[model samples]
Target: MKLYWSSRSPFVRKVMVFAHECGLAERIVCVRTVVAMTKPNVDLLPVNPTGKIPTLLLDDGSALYDSAVICEYLDSLHGGPRLFPESGPARWTALRRHALGNNLTDNLMLWRNETLRPQPQQSPEILAAFELKVRNAVAALEHEAAALAADPVSIGHVAIACALGYIDFRFAALDWRTGHDRIARWYETFARRPSMVLTAHVDQ
Candidate 1:
C-alpha cells in the first residue's frame, strides 16, 4: 500500500499513527504530495477526486481516503485491539467523541482560513461563528473527556488528541488551554505516546 502523504496534515498524521499503533507501518510506503484547497494539484485528481491528503492506494490500484476510514482499515489488519470498539454503548460513545472532535477540527480550520484572507475580503460573521463553535466544542470535550480519563486510548481519544494538536498548530493565539485544565492535562500525557512523539508536527 502507498499513502499519498503530507507532514503537515493532521488527518494524514492520524492515519499514520493508527498504522504504527497497529504494527502495519512497515507494510505501507509513504509518497509525499501537496494539495492546496485554494489551488489543488491537478495531478492528484485521479488519485482522489477531492484532492485530499492521506489517500491510500492499494496493491490493485484501488484508492481509499479520509482518515477515519483509513484508520479503521488499518485496525482490521490486526486482530482486535480495535481502536473502534465492537458492540455496546462504548461504540456509540467513541463514535460521538470522534464526530465531535472532527467538528472541532473543522471549525478550527475554518477559523484559520478566515484569518488568512485579506482584511477587506474576510467575513467577520463567519469567523465569529466558527470561533464560537470551536469554544463550545472544546468545552464539551473537556467535560466529557474528564469522565473518560481512566481509559484514554480509544478512537475518540485519538481524535481529541489530533484536534488539540491542530489548534496549537494553527490557532495558538486562541490559548484554549486556559480554563480547560483537565483536557490540557489529558493532552500532555497523550502527546507523550510513541505514536504522537514520532509524528510531531514540524512546519513545512
Candidate 2:
C-alpha cells in the first residue's frame, strides 16, 4: 500500500498512528505529498480528486480516502485486537470520541489556515469562534480524561491524541495544557507511544 502523506497533516498522522498500532506500518509506503488550502496538488487530483494527503493506494489499483475510512480498512487487515469496537456501547463511545477529536482537528486546521492569511485578510470573528470552540473541546476532553485512561485503547484515543498533538505542533501559543491537567497528563503518556514518537510532526 502507498499513502499520500505529509509530515505536517494531523489527519495523516492519525492514520499512520493507527497503522503502527495495528502492526501495519511496515506494509505502507509513505509518499510525501504536499497539499495546501490555496494550492491543490494537480498530480494528486488524478488519484484523489480532493487532493488530500493520507489517501491510500491499494495494491490492486484501488484507493481509499478519509482517515476514518482508511483506518477501518487497515483494522480489517490486522488480526489483533480491534481499535474500533465491534458492537454495543463500546462502539458508540469510541465513535463519539472519534467524532469529537476529528472535529477538533478540523477546526484547528481551519484556524491555522485563517492565521496564515495576510493579517488584513484574516477574519477576527472566525478566529475568535475557533478559539472558543477549541477551549470548549479541551474542557470536554479534560472531563473525560479518566474514562479515556481506563478504557482499552481505541481509534477514539488515537484521534484525540492527534488533535492534541496538532495543537502542540501549530498552536503552541495556545498553551492548552495550562488548566486541563487531567487530559494534559493523559496526553503526556499517550504521546510517548511508539506510534506517536515515530510520526512526530515536522514543519517542512
TM-score per candidate: 0.95, 0.99
Instruction: Kindly list the per-residue Cα lDDT of model 1 for residues 1-204, writing each as its tens digit.
Output: 999988887888888777877878889898888876688988789989999888999999999988888888887889758889886888888888888877788787778778888999999899889988898888887787576687636788878888899888888888999998989998898889888888777677
Residue-by-residue lDDT tens digits, candidate 2, 127-149: 99999999999999999999999
Which residue pairs show collisions in model 2? Answer: none
Off by over 4 Å in 1: none
lDDT of 2: 0.97
Any runs in candidate 2 off by more than 4 Å, and if so which?
Answer: none
**Cα-based lDDT at residue 111, candidate 1:** 80
- Per-residue error for 124 in candidate 1, Å, reads 0.8
lDDT of each model, Cα atoms only?
0.83, 0.97
Give the 10-residue window scoring lowest on summed lDDT in candidate 1: 145-154
